[model samples]
Structure formats: C-alpha cells, structure tokens
Target chain A: MLDDVVFWVLAVVAVAAGVAVFRVDSMARATYALAVSFVAVGLVLLLFDLQFLGVITVLMMVMEMAIMAIYMIMFMGMNPALMPMSMVHAKRPSLAVAVVTFVVLASGAVLIPWPSRRGAPASDLTVSLGQALMGSKMLVMMTVSAVLFATIIGALVLAVPRGRYDRLGDDLRGRVDADQPDGAGQ
Target chain B: MTLQTVLLVAAALFSVGLYGAISQQVVVMVMMGLELMLNAVVLAAGGFWWFLSPAPDGQVLLLVVITAMTVEMAMGFAVATLLHRTRNEDMTDMATDLAQ
Candidate 1:
C-alpha cells in the first residue's frame, strides 16, 4: 500500500512538472521543471526495482538540465530567455491534440488485455544485466558506444564557431590564436 | 503500482510533452518537450519490465532509450547553436526559409 502511494505521488509530480515546463514563463524555469519531472520518473523507476536505470536517470537528467541552462543563456540572443516571455504558440490546437492523444492512450491502457507473466525475475538483476551486456548483447553495446562517440564528435564539430584550422593556422603549429578566448584553450 | 495506473501516468506525461512540442516556439523548449516524452517512455518501459517481462533485455532497452535521449539532446543543442549563429533566429517560424 505504501509502495502504491509513493508511485502515485511520483507520478503526479512527474506529470505536473511536465505541464509546468510549458506553463512557466522563463526558459530556465521550464528547463528545471523538466528536470524535476525526469527526477520524479527516475524515482518511480527505482520503485520498480530498476536501480541502475533509476540512478542513472537522476544523474544524467540533472546534468543535462544544467548543461541545457547554460546553453539557453548562452544561445538565446538579446537575453530573451532571461526575461519573462510567452513560451508557446498555437496553443489551442496543441491542447486539443494532446487531449485526444491522452484519451486514446489511457483508454487503451485500461481496456487492453495484457499478457500474464511467464517466469519469475532473475535473483540478481544487475549481475544478469552485466552478463547480458558482455554476452549476447555485446554487439548492441558496441554499436551504441560507437554512436555515442560519433555524437560527441559531431556535436562538437557543429557547435564550435571556429575550427582547428582557424585556431592553429595552415600548418597547424600555432601556439595560441589571437582570437581565442581566455581559459578556452589548453 | 498496477500496470494500468503506471500506463495512465505515462500517457499523461506524454500528452503534456506533445502539447509543449507542438506549441512551444523556442528550439530549446521543443527539445524539452521531446525529453519529457522520452521520460514518459522510460517510466512505461520500467513498468512493463517490472510487471510483465522482468528481463535484462528490458533494462538494456531502457539504457538504449536513455542513450538515444542524450545523443538527440546533444545534437539538438548543436543544431540550435548553428541556427542561431547562421540565421540569428531561434523561433521555429523564423526558420521557415529552410523549408524552401
């Protein structure tokens, strides 16, 4: 009974914070609201016995929100994100669509005849998960690693305003570029 | 703790995200909407694994989802930076020229 209560409370917090993301005026508030929503969902995952995912979710989301706040402040020209501004557009149609989607999904959740569990859970979930990653799912893990590396490189390439060529000169042997900002270079 | 209740919560979260994604004018706000939607997916997947499958594969799937969310958000920030630098615009409506 206590578990159910906790789950419901987290669920409410998650959904309410999600709603607040758009309702809030400032971009920082919206970003932190989404972070709160993710943290609540992470707690719900913990309730479901997904320890690694729950903890990772909390950590990753908090970090992501912090980075997002930095980007919002940095990228938003004229300090618009810092000022109070309307965050939404075409609100009526969006509301209608969201309402319809929720109704359909909720009805399906209540009406569908779900399958029963066929077997019990593993005694040591983390051990089994590690074994699976090192065993049958090794290929998937490798691919994901590659993808993550590529994402890091790709995002950096896109985000950096000046390339190495510009910083290092044609021969790539410049000690420090004149245009380089302080504390930005090694 | 029942599947129905968990799913209902997911549905609510997803719908709110949908609203934000569709209605938000700012690029980062839209990304936040997308993240919220993925957050709902994570919750629903955890519920499914706990109540139905109870396997390592489900956990792996959640991990992949989280990784994808991270990758997508990173790329989104990069793209937003590029757009702002090149066009000096952040609103979706201002980028309509890209559709041409």
Candidate 2:
C-alpha cells in the first residue's frame, strides 16, 4: 500500500516537474525543479529496494544542479534564475516535433510486451550485483572512472584564469602579476 | 503501476527530453533536457529490475548512470565558463562562430 502511494506521488511529481523544467521562465527555478523531480524518482527507486542506486541518484542530481547553479552565476552573471527569458528559440516546429515524438515513443512503450524473470533472484542480491559487475563489467566501470578523471583535469584547465606563474614569479615569490592578453589566458 | 506502465512513462519522458535537447537554444536548458533523458533511462532500469530480473545488477547500472550525469554536468559547466569569458554571450545564436 505504502509503495503504491509513493509510486503514484513520485510519478506525478516527476512528470510535472519534467514539464516545468522547460516551462519555467527563470533558469534557477527550472534547475531546482528538475533536481527535485530527480530526487523524488530516486526515492521511489529506494522504495523498490534498490538502495544503492536510489542514494546515488539523489546525491548525483543535487551536486549536478548545484554546479549548474554556479555556472549560471559565473557565466550569465545576471541571475538568469530571477529574470524571465525565453530559453526556447525555434518554438512552433520544435513543439510539433516534440509532440509527435512523444506520441510515437509512448505508443511503443505501451505496445511492447516486457519479458518476465527467467529464474529466481540471487540469494544475496547486492553480492550478486557486485560479482556480476566486477566479473564482467569491470572494464566499463574503469572506463567511466577514467573519463571522469579526464573531465576534471580538462575542466580545471579551462575554468581557471591563472596558474602558478601568475601568483608567483618564475624563480620564486616576487609580487608577480602576469599581464596576459585577452584570449591568451587559457 | 505495473512494469509496462512504468516503462511507457519512462519512454515518454525520454522522448520529450530528446526533443528539448535537439531544439533548445540555451545550453543550460539543453543540459536539463539531458538530465531528464537520463532520468528516464534510470526508471527503465529500475522497472526491469522490479519485474524482469529482480536483481541488483540492474540497480548498479542505474547508479552508474547517475554518476555519469554528474560528470557531464561538471564538464559542461566548466566549458560554459570558458565560453562566457571568450564571448560575452550565452545564447546559442551567438555561438555560431564554430560553425562559420
């Protein structure tokens, strides 16, 4: 009973917020609404007994939205959250396409007959997951980790304005300030 | 709802998100669209686990997708910062220099 209640509530909230994400006038409001939606869905996943995935989903979206907020502040620097701006560019055509696509895909989803379980669930579901992941999917996991690492390094390189050379002289500390030209800092 | 219903909802969400991603002008909106798409994928995984597999592996895959979303957001933000510094605009209309 509780699961059903949670599922319906979350499902409603997710759909509503997902739509509001595009409908909102302000960028910040949309970002937070989207985050809330994702977090709600994550909680629903937890209700399904997928504790690890649920927890990660909530954490991941919170952090991602926070970073997006920071970017909005730094780049737009005009509180795109408070101000109303039309984020949409090509409206009528995009709207038509979006509607058609949603109809076709949703139809496929309703029409398809999902498969049933072939066997009983593993005795220790978590342990089985870990074994399966490590036994066969270790390479994919490693690749993702490496990709994240590279992204961090690349982002650092791009976002930071000055390096060690700007703070300190080549030899040592000398109240140094490199007067770099525009478009040459990075 | 049943697994089929859950999947149908997920697919709808995914398609909506994809449409937004392809058509949205603002980069941040595009990113939000991407997040929505990822959310749909996660829902499908969870539904599969609940109805078809009932195992933790499907759940783990969903967790990995969450992690990937975080990474994508972080990288996107950093690039946005760089672009802002180079050009005083955030709209995709002004970003046509790359195409030119």
lDDT of 1 by residue, B62-90 (tens): 98999999998999999999999988888
Model 1 sits at a Cα RMSD from the real structure of: 2.7
Clashes of each: 0, 0
Per residue, candidate 1 scores C-alpha lDDT tens digits across A1-186 of 999999989989999999999888888888889999999999999888888889999999999999998888887744645688795788999999999999999999999998987577788787887888999999879999999999999999898888876677788787775555731265
For residue B15, give model 1's deviation from the true position in Å.
Answer: 0.7
Query: Relative to the true structure, how large is the alpha-carbon lDDT of every model?
Result: 0.89, 0.77
Candidate number with greatest lDDT = 1
Off by over 4 Å in 2: A162-186
Per model, the share of native interface contacts recovered reads 0.85, 0.65
For candidate 2, the per-residue lDDT at A19 reads: 82
